[model samples]
Target: MKKKITVKLDIQKIVRITGNHGGYETGECLLCEASGWLEGEFGSPYSTKDTGADLVHKKNCLMNKVLA
Candidate 1:
């Protein structure tokens, strides 16, 4: 039998990397005003790719959705 490997995203690490004073996530949030989340843009922060934190902005931030 072969084992499957799964890699889960760490919200705490994402929060720290963003220079925020908190670390936590609940369910699948698109944009959490209480948490100060900002959706995503269509351009590039460049460094975001290096740290792999873009997932929060693109997948959960919900900023873009709000703008629409």
Candidate 2:
């Protein structure tokens, strides 16, 4: 019989890496007005990307702003 190898992963590390840390901070979500959110120009903000249908701006706006 062969033994199986199972590796356990940390959820906190995964969340931090995946950038899925949900919380109320500053500059986080432009829509929800969250903080610690990434900012960038994802999609065409001047085009149909801001039709309230496509929320590609949020994804594009991933700015890393740290507090002093």
TM-scores of the candidates are: 0.20, 0.22
Alpha-carbon runs more than 4 Å astray in model 1: 1-4, 17-56, 59-68
Tens digit per residue, CA lDDT, model 1, 1-68: 99998655444343322333254222223233222232342222223443433333343453334333
Span of 10 residues, lowest total lDDT, candidate 1 = 38-47
In lDDT terms, which candidate is top? 1
Candidate 2 global CA lDDT score: 0.30
- Superposed on all Cα atoms, model 2 deviates from the true structure by an RMSD in Å of 14.0
User: Which candidate leads the pack in TM-score?
Assistant: 2
lDDT of 2 by residue, 1-68 (tens): 99998655432332221244364212223432323332232222222334443222333332111110
